[model samples]
Target chain A: MTGAACVLGVDSGGSGLRAALGSPEGAPCAGPVRSAEPVRTGPRGIDAGHFMDLLLPLARDLLAASGGGRIAAVAVGAAGMATLGEGLRAELPGALGRELGAERVALAADAVTAYAGALGERPGAVVAAGTGLIAVGTDLAAWRRADGWGHLLGDCGSGAWIGRAGLEAAMRAHDGRRGGSPALRDRAEKVFGPAAGLPGQLYPRADRPAVLASFAPEVAACAAGDAVAGGILRDAARHVAEAAAAVCPRDAASEVALTGGLIKLGEPLLGPLRDDLAELLPHARQVPAAGDPLDGALRIAGGLAADRLLLPRDARMLSVHRSEGPSTSA
Target chain B: MTGAACVLGVDSGGSGLRAALGSPEGAPCAGPVRSAEPVRTGPRGIDAGHFMDLLLPLARDLLAASGGGRIAAVAVGAAGMATLGEGLRAELPGALGRELGAERVALAADAVTAYAGALGERPGAVVAAGTGLIAVGTDLAAWRRADGWGHLLGDCGSGAWIGRAGLEAAMRAHDGRRGGSPALRDRAEKVFGPAAGLPGQLYPRADRPAVLASFAPEVAACAAGDAVAGGILRDAARHVAEAAAAVCPRDAASEVALTGGLIKLGEPLLGPLRDDLAELLPHARQVPAAGDPLDGALRIAGGLAADRLLLPRDARMLSVHRSEGPSTSA
Candidate 1:
């Protein structure tokens, strides 16, 4: 008889992708048990085939490490998979099935796993703002989404958005259309190049984050005085709070869980966001994403097996007695 | 006797410093009116003695190039010399005298020169936003004022300020404080780096345009649907217009001239700034700067010898010739 079976959960992040495997007890059966990988999924779009190619081997390695030598179920969360739809979903499981011959594969939005990670199997909202911003939640039926319109349309409160705003401000200052902020101007130039000396070639080839994220520290630096940076943060916080409020369950007390690359930078942004949320949504509780999203995905994986999403025999076979295994973490 | 003596006007720019001999007709003389030299002043602050080093060579070159070996007059409109006061006035001429002998040197703020170039000795406000920003006007006397507070404090409507604001907005969104704008987010990541990634390592070492300038196009892209970038730009334009209004002289019918890299990037910022100015200062006339700040500086060089503070004969000769010298267009 197979021991305690486990489910694997995978999360693709900005810096890297993580995987985790766990049992019903919320205990890990195998690995998380991995680090992040940098895959450039930008406006140009990720090569779904290439992404699958990269992931299957990792999954196989994770499964081999599991004691049961098999993963009963698998769920993955990705960063820029907007157009993936069923085609991408099918490719995920099909690749895994061909590699390990696993029993079942469930594919959901990265936000779903993040939501599960934050709520730990319960219903809640997860707003991930990194290179992009997507606010997601779960109700009795389908997953609910308030925003995530891509860079051109939606995603008001995101690192990319804020960074862009800061850069624009810097440019305005540089151009004299705006006044001047020494700290901001200094910060941008320090990161990219001398404002006055930027080469025509460099402007077109300039990377987004290399130039945009450079101003983040300046924003915090100037938060004490630079009204433009401060105002941007304040306004962003209001918009984010509004987004979370939009999908938050009307009846029950909503737990708004925030995650992603931006929050880690710390204060000015955090303080204002918190204050703004409190003012905007009295009933909702604002909190930092508990652990990494991978953990949430793992919990979801465990819960799925425990809650009869998988056959009891399959669960048993995939769980327990593991030296190492496929990841279950969100 | 001396091959038709001439004056040289040197306008120090962000890309490099340009030395020119302008005729009274407002044309540059000789070959290569402008040449590449390192930008001496920026938000980060000036080089230790870079100012003197740049000015000295510029003057010597002008003398050597002039058929009128005896430069009649020397007029200089240097950027960031506002705080230098008479000390700059004294030091610049003194430095030139060391090179070509202490005959005549007419030095003034680059802002004044820009005024002459754009308004042709008329009274108006010239707002220059390059890597930094300042608003200057030509009244009966030379007027100088610092608008944007070096990218740290002021700079209401500058690129750096806008970029900083956009980044802050992203962070707020990450914290569940605000909504998200994908355009801003994608642009930030492209310009700066992945959200919350290792910022210290990711940021460029030199002062660069805010990452947001990269995404500024996105703001315009999303303006039809995105409220965040649009709102940010609208507010930025309004704020910048306010600064211009504050600096424009009350005595004359205020003609606000817009000049900067941000404006060249296209709409979002420019259109909104123009609209905001119209709303803020109905009486003020908005006009595109007739030429770049360097041109303005050249104009100042010509004017200083002819009008305003007087210069010696040789200095005046240099000015008229420099104005007619070969320019970038030539």
Candidate 2:
């Protein structure tokens, strides 16, 4: 006989996609498969066809390796899903049902999954910072978000924001202007070549945010000795905390967590970030993230399979679709 | 005598190309012929072939329209000439000599031309604030520039910068975050459709800087009653003045001038800009621009033709190339 039914969870982000298989009890089963290439987004938002193409083979491999079981439910957490998820919401459910025999599917914004993974249906806020930064909160009632405006208009305290600022300081140093950092200039020239050619190097690329974010680590590396670089991180920290405070629940009992690749910048970013968060959101209890976005996706999948989901649903942030029949069993 | 040996002057910018014919005495002789499309730039930097294709026909048309003057000299001022001008510097002199029978050619950064138009080789700074912001100064020795790093990195206090700040405020209002402007939000939604669709509309376009700059006037328009919008402009003025201060010569008699399309925003921008300029550049005299960039190009061409060009030569900022042999006369 085939193994017990399993749930599939996938987290798609700027770095790539991560998928895991889990039991209804939230225990990991087969594989947390990863693909380093992010799913492409197009005119229709998240390209459902491209997503399925990347996903189905991996799902099949996970299922086969785990002794072949029916997919009871599936959950996908994706970047840009809040604004650009029309394609995924409309097509993912039917496609999942047809291909994986999933009777329940949850489509969620990556922030929502980040929240689920970090706090697990609790009433609080979670700041997800990577190439971009966003804060999502739930009093277990409705979702609130701030920032995540991409590299152009906002994402103020994000990796891209820090990298762009660092590069700007480098350019200023090159031009012999005030507020420049020679240390950051050296780092930037080492990384991106001469400061004069930076605009030509950066502006044309379609993946400009990622390209900009790639330099964030360099900024962090220079922060210890360079006042300008350190100032950039402090300002970045303030913005990040402000974003979190914007979306964090005001209740004293609420918890806040910080997650994502930016935390890897470590103490230079985190030190000011902690101070800012304390000053900005005094009522909330700061906490460590319990898990990652893929784990959150898995948790949501397991919750959907078990009919125990407690997170609030929103049309864009988190939407659930059900197959119009009784639950399938292995 | 073919119209007393007139010179050719061309201004290539974000808006388009504008060409004029002038006598060696710096008086206009023929049409300021316009081409609505800006010359295309490529990986090799400021496509020389495309520039020639656009300019040759226009030069011929201007010559025919003005009774066929001998092109004694040609000067072309282009937007990215300070950096992305290798292609132009390499091929323009030879081509202009062969096609228009021009013996002298001056290729200048648009800011250099703007300075020539505004202050005319004097010891002062000129802040050229248009779609992008750049301040160029000269003590009649060498050019000093601040900002002009393009829309992505710097260009602080630029049209694009102001418009981006306005849009960010609009997005903040949409997200119900602090520092949001509902007035700006209403304006943005009207101009760009729903708040949610902005990233989709903007980030893909190659002309993002121009698109962002298109809203700067709206920001200026709302500054009268809206504090957030007003704040944005005030900050813009500060940045503009800061750029000017960064490049301005620290001499008691040095002059400063403001030039470019952004001047049309009127007193709302100018009021604060005046305050900041007066405070930051107290040593320099403030002056109105005598003419636009096309006039500056014409002046440079005239100067080149008469062998009286006084501006310092820089390989990237203001390069001049002369043909071998004696000067060709009409």
Candidate 3:
């Protein structure tokens, strides 16, 4: 281990935060360290202080493990960066420079990272569907986004949305109402106890979106044999495709990719999603995501380190900051 | 004022708590004191100690206002009493006997109180649609309930539900997606600022349901001219009516009633609600509520004071408790 230049990449989202060390050539060196607790947000916006608290320790560990190499650049892709990112955009760069002595930084919305990870800097759209969903695309100039409105308002085809729809069907079944799904009800009971007590269990929790999303797998599991569950998946797929179509580049040769943990729902979701994407976005070629958001963050960091970043910069979607002070090599 | 035998009635719900003093004849005699904070609930169930803290002070004021009359009985109608009332039920009786000197007590679910308030002891269903929605009924035997699953899972057609739907439409419009409602978007922006910031504004709040429900009136206000808003209300009405039909007794002359603050949305909601109820439950008659939950609580307390309560008692829905020792007149 020598005083080699390495870049820091971080992915912060609903599930948690992950950090990695990468070289300017886009190769990982060591440490994809993780923290299960997500960065907190509040009245001002995404809590920059909380994010720094989480990242500083992770960066120190990664640097130590990499034999005290100097960090040339840092890129952070955070979940709420597009909307609730004022605090992060304003404070993160200065804080990183002061603390880590990293002069070059790229702050990006998680969706943009997913896009970069999926299609590099090419003109394409990427659907990042996890607990929440967002579709992002660029024509090598400007970015377009759809959905990712969180669980209550939008995120229409996201994991939370599917879970909520499934839970509603389960509740309907419990109440013996129309559109009830007995299979979903059974699954719901197995996971969340009796239907009657669900409100008491769910409403008071702060992590409700993720809690609701925890049931998405159950819905996907029941999709194979249950028409109602299958219907839910089909609708979810349609919504995902619609979001993708809303932001995908218009060119026939442009690419569309799916990324995030939700892709693990596998064929039950993918089968319908494929058909919907074909119908809604026939011109765009659907492709598998080359990597996850972490990989995307690393790639962006690498690009910044080499001063050859090709992706278009947007104030909210993706912004680069360079400190005026001389770099302090570790 | 003489030392008359007055009953203590308390209504505890999402909005707050209210306590009134009434004579055994079911006539109000003194005060209806209020506390704006709702009683807290936790893993142990509805916080009995907190309820006591709020109730004791209000009870003292009511008793003092009534010229120190003896409380013959006490009735408390609380939201979530059907499911989250274990702590309240177990501890309230003993606490009330010691604190209020009332030997007899009736603990009722808010829906049961709403039913009692609406149609007395008649075999009918009552839809309690406010921030949340629940339909409860009795056939002079057992209690039946449908849909009160709260904001996350069910609570279909509730104030929160309508508001959430309206906000979703607003987001769709903001995103330039199909099914976008520009009218709703305008209304939402007026109430909640930019559409993109709504999730950040909503998701972190413990009072999210109330906050979301605050937007419901805007949806109602727009229903007359906006088709999307009209559609949301129509769907809300259908959901409310379906919930009512699910619980209404099968008797040809059984009554159905709508109760709760949601009824204030007026013709935009009620017009569709009336038609849907008429279509869904032609056998049952729709009736205006005779009183609110507070009045129902007073009525139940009065009935208990006279030992002629007519409504069938259920362990979860409604339960009666009598202290073993002699009653203490205040």
Candidate 4:
């Protein structure tokens, strides 16, 4: 039997997969509230078969971890599902529904949960800066997207983008082609090892996204004293701030919430981002994410209508908004 | 069996493989001498074994096309050989020697031949910007390289880099993340069909380097009328100029020659690059390539001391600058 007050919410991202069991009100009610693993997936995408293999077992573990308390409802905010064809998207929620029972399911692009997690029922914008960057916003029923074009095309203020800029600076410094901190080049070279050998080590590796993002921390770590690193951070934050500022529609709220892995690095990037945003979006506020994405997933999973989630037409939304008994049925 | 006065020069670049049969004096002597085929190679790098399979036959055909020329020597100025260890470098010339009765052969980085082709023994600097950008220069025996770093690490003013920047601008315009020409977004979308489906089509292709470089032309096409595209081209040329200027040592003769596929776009890119170099490197004069890389390769193969062609310790410099018939001995 499941706790009548609790529901299950799962969030999948480039860095890890996370799951939590929480109250209908989006609060943790039991243990194993958040479980994460070093699982690999991506913006370039993975086959549905592989994605499900990772997803199904993780859900079962969380459900079992709930100690016989049934999953009152289930919602998954999965990456890459937003871009898939309708046929491919049906597989995830369908498979999960078969296992966890039907009437308790909701699925969406991680981008939607990111916006919900930041803004809740209120309207504004959320720019998630992680290994990759994408912003989602809504002004009533109209949806807007800004810069989540993946690694190749766009992702302006993302960890990978910052990392690439930092690496380029390091190379320019080493070549003495420009005036940058020698210390920045030293730190960057240490990441890849000796003397101009970065290309050899970096290109052949399959885990390119993680490796590219791995340099992002160095930009923050050196920004304080290194001119080159500081310039890079400043430029990165400017791009992010510009993107974030553009997404705000000045509707119900004018506050923008920042989320994802890169945000955790703090000031070296964000301070500049905030300063730039203040100039570009003078009336708005840059705020922290009030709750995590799982909360937002659960909020939608409950009977809250988040039309922006845009689940495929055939995707069955099993609304289970009840607060009594360990019932899997709505 | 062979024309005593002839030599062969092959220019193997990311864009295409071009081979020419010419006199030992480095002048083209036959029809369609610079024959090229759309062969697959790489940013991933093609192996020497595969390279030879493509090379040997092409050389023999070019030799035969020249009406039975006893090649005085053969040189292939290929991309990607610069970073290879001595063992790998040995394979190209060794295979070419056995195929053609040539006594002398030379192996060097494509950058060196690029410099030789542009400046010859009259040293200065040469900035070759194609799918990739590399600036090479010479001051007596001292050689300097500025930004030949491939698509991942450097290649700052390259076709691939420009295309990537242009695509990012297009995405930004499409997303309304920045104020830009919608025309740029439309043109970019035309290249890869649909606004949202680009990342899907682009990221999965095996010929990522070629495809990325393909957009460089569009940057030029739009720059005259579009602010976004104009900014990208201006930035690209500036980087190329700085790199080129930095490589030159202000010798008695200070000139920087511009070469590569991107050069054909002409004024929009080159005009800014020239103006930027005038300010950054006042003493330098910007000029066109004296000859293509194949000519430089022929010079090296003809036993001209292209000492700038730095070979590894174990690399044998078999010199056969003889005026006689087909002879294998040096």
Candidate 5:
């Protein structure tokens, strides 16, 4: 069934989900895709079926706007898909077919799409560092991940990780338990002011990692030679390098592609991370992602259609299915 | 004139001003001295004259409870005054004489008492690390200070400084700009919740630094082996050592004392700081204050009266000044 074939891609994260349609170049679809309220993914991330339930109606609305033309395919790249394995892989395709009346559905981790978008569905690794840090790689059909231990046990090379480190320094400096770096001390007081005392006030609520993660750039400035702040960046880079190395598979063609907010520390962190990773994996190739993860998902859909492994409408339907597959209301 | 004479020591921080009366053995005076709202010192750390203005009346109140007997003499060690010259120092005596009707008033920086509290008023240095940091030394009639830059330019080894450092690290981690310790991020999320993403909420509040400062122990913990956190503490300890060495005149004769909330980091920071200082000045002496700074002030007052410099009624009037000075006005 192919009539003005359409494809949809959705990228959901801790805060919200973003969906787009059309070709890999960010071309607009013939119709509109509906959006819904942001659902709290919790500490473990979002549930796939529940995510599909939320997205299906929105996908239908978009397809219905296509003036009665059948949707070709649907694909989704979401934040929490890494936590799901084979037992859950079929959940998405089944839900999308049932909910959106689609002919074909493609299920893959958001990291897969991110990898695809950044370097196309090729052989490489993607470091998805947002509120947290996780390194993912694809060796054709096999997928591997490392360092997504949330904000507590792991996530050494993430925004949250850096933020948490910064907070500890500030606390020590503020109490005079430790001598403070001029740069780090200045940034904390500039943002929080002098009256910011009392340990409990530093974290009266939850989601502190996100709060601390917000100051990543400030630390970058310090790391760029501001004596007090430079160490923070230097240390953070080391953590990221460890994470990337942890996920690199032995005897695989490893092309490391960096993603996420923490890389903004630029040279101070990135340069060191590169040097360290090279020391560990002498033959590891560093690849920069060209586009976002959703684009990678779309590219995958396009390639499938081109290869006839999936039909044009099948690809379009799969794309639409991805947008609506996570929240399939039970 | 002397009817069971007692000494009262007052410590005024940004949070609150508390007065305590007791002996060097840690026994409470016949009655509690007094306490009041935190007097705004206005950054440059409260001038000697202004301190007298607020303190004299409080002294009188405390003295009045002595029941018409002498308070022996009054000694006040404030956060500032170490940098004040003879002219500024003279004004304090006049202010106390006129305001509280005292014959003797000894005005100096809390560093003096902090040091004395740590080393019994002998020649030594006290690292006064509270909301701010000050390294002070005393040699007979002269006093010297260094590294108490308040919250703005200096305060290298202070609670405010550490809090600021932690915040910057967390921000970098949040934005994915750098990897950081897991502390500030988690702590911040706990304090601010969803609003933790909003940096403004973590700053410029009464409890921000106080809350952040509470993590001094964490910095110490991390410094012991927490990698990212250890770096923060080591950096701070170095700063504190530099500040201490800078203020202490002769390294051979200098006794370094540690005070303030930062000291709670215990041996983690202190041990490293001592080692660092040893490298800078092998003969530099280190010790914890025998008690709080206010207690040292009382001891100084007792010593002054024992030497017959102040009449008995002078002490009584100082007590009256603290308790009845404000109320007698209207």
Candidate 6:
């Protein structure tokens, strides 16, 4: 009954939000996800009430679609919480809290889930380069984080980074500083205006990340022909590879997983990333994650991979737990 | 007699503001200037009201000190207006508009004035690497600009940029990702707090530019020993030099003028800048500006170097003028 007690997983990302329902071994149901902000639990602080308000609706929608059967467990993989653990535990603001059953709900950062989904709780690094970029790695001895210092400081090889680089190059070309693609110019004009007044057109806008991300595809498309765009993609790849290498180190690594929207750019981004990874860290091989972060979330929720969670030992209670139905008799 | 046809020069910079009153020949009387914003006219757009408020008092004070001299002309050299020859004419919100006689006043961008002050109307590139960085060069035939893309996109060699890099390095160090100076952490703590949470402690601050700029000295000081800090400074120098090289091409060069508060850090910034310029553009040699931006502004106002003024052909009337008494014959 109820397909042997299915598990639910949620991914809260900058680009979109997705909920996965069903057994990890079977075809999980996901999607019609909404793009929204991740959990706001940090030094600036998170609001648990607000977090529940945003998540419950999405969860209920998924549950309603699941044949109205009994629910087993729930897991969440969120960007804000994704490499959380280290010193960030005490500062975490009741992440996911007891809004659900409190016993069957588990919360892990997006990187951990990506790691679990990609490498199955193994020791290695995983780079999630989407609208944002961050590389989190564990060699089972030391934890290392590379880049993902947000969009302003580092985030070297992210889609946003690539988009920004492309836009800057386009602006430079327009200002007669360099040669750029007309198509690139068109893309800029489409978003930033035909006058090409970049700073005025870009900085003040609230959706700067999204605006920049929209240009990422243009950069990837232009990489085949345009030198500037091509160069940007190559640089992005190098940065991404370097980030992965920064975490994995020499002796304690195996698989480096590359995930997120930018990975879907295919050859333009991956080709160079792979080349750079070989040069930067030969021991760690780049591998496709075996499952989505949702799968990793499910694994953590179902107690299938509890050890895979990356929280500090004192803060295992940080994950939210909820239980229901005959399968997970909490 | 109102001081025998004197002119006023204003230097509005990231660090402080200065107004000069003296004859056109020698160094004009300057200082007691408040650090303030420049002309409010750029693609990203800037505010000039703050500049006027800060300047009017300084100008009034200088006028008072001048013993009521006949102000023949006034010139302003401001960062915001440094590259403002484009579509920012009508939008300039009363920079020297009515605070003084608008006609006799000549407003030139800081980079052009920097070029004049350093090279005296000579065809060359001038790099202003203060809290903000922008390089403008004139080959007598065409005008070219490099970098100065603002803190978000470019301004690669600027003090603000360097400080940001240094802070990022500090964050990495605190996170156990990299080795950094305890002094660096101390500086960050002083500014951001002992919590040392970067983005949360930072991004929301109102005076981010000033805060970032304050760390530049620490970066310069650490250049001699700390690898990370040293790396940041070297990169800064290279970027600054590259900006100069970008604007001033090979054949059309006179000399590259390096001027700014950051330049005061001496060889740490200048050494690598010179080296990079040598490699990047062999024709350009680094030189100290012949005079300060005040001198350049004076030159522009007295119309001694009208061609040096980097304003649109149609709207050179942005500068302010106040004439009285016998010398000016107003």
Using TM-score as the yardstick, the better of models 3 and 5 is 3
In DockQ terms, which candidate is top? Answer: 4
- Report the lDDT tens digits of candidate 2 across residue range A5-32: 8899999987788898999866679789
Residue pairs with clashing backbones, model 3 = none
Determine the iRMS, in angstroms, of model 5. 11.2
**DockQ for each numbered candidate:** 0.06, 0.63, 0.62, 0.69, 0.04, 0.32
lDDT of each: 0.57, 0.88, 0.88, 0.69, 0.58, 0.65
User: For candidate 5, what is the lDDT?
Assistant: 0.58
> Residue-pair clashes per candidate, as listed?
162, 0, 0, 9, 130, 22
User: What's each prediction's TM-score?
Assistant: 0.56, 0.94, 0.88, 0.87, 0.56, 0.80
Q: What are the per-residue Cα lDDT tens digits for candidate 3 across A101-146?
A: 7878999998888887888878888998989988888888889999
lDDT of 5 by residue, B1-330 (tens): 345555556665555555655542333463444455555444344555555556665666666665544444466665544433233354555554445444445654666667666766566567878667777665434455555644433566577667656554554454333445566656545555531233435443556545556555545555565566666777778878876765565746667778877788777677779888887656767766777777766766666656532211222112222222222333
Q: How accurate locally is residue B59 in candidate 1, as Cα lDDT from 0 to 100?
A: 60
The digit string of per-residue lDDT tens for model 5 on A41-84 reads 54434565667767766766665665544444565666545443
Per residue, candidate 4 scores C-alpha lDDT tens digits across B53-133 of 666677767766777866666666767656652443545556665667654556556776677677776667888888889
The CAPRI quality class of candidate 1 comes to incorrect
Candidate 6 CAPRI grade? acceptable
lDDT of 1 by residue, B1-330 (tens): 255555566676556777766564346675334546754543434442566676566665665676545444565666554443334443555455555442455555565566555655555566666445566654444453435444433455566656655654554444344445665666666665665541332243355344434444555555556688778778767766766665566654667776766575468778877787777667677777777655555555555555553222222112222222222113
Give the CA lDDT, 0 to 100, for residue A104 in model 3. 89
* Poorly placed runs, candidate 3 (over 4 Å): A1-9, A14-74, A83-104, A302-308, A323-330, B1-7, B21-72, B91-103, B305-307, B324-330
Model 3 DockQ (Cα-based)? 0.62
Candidate 3 lDDT at B279 equals: 95
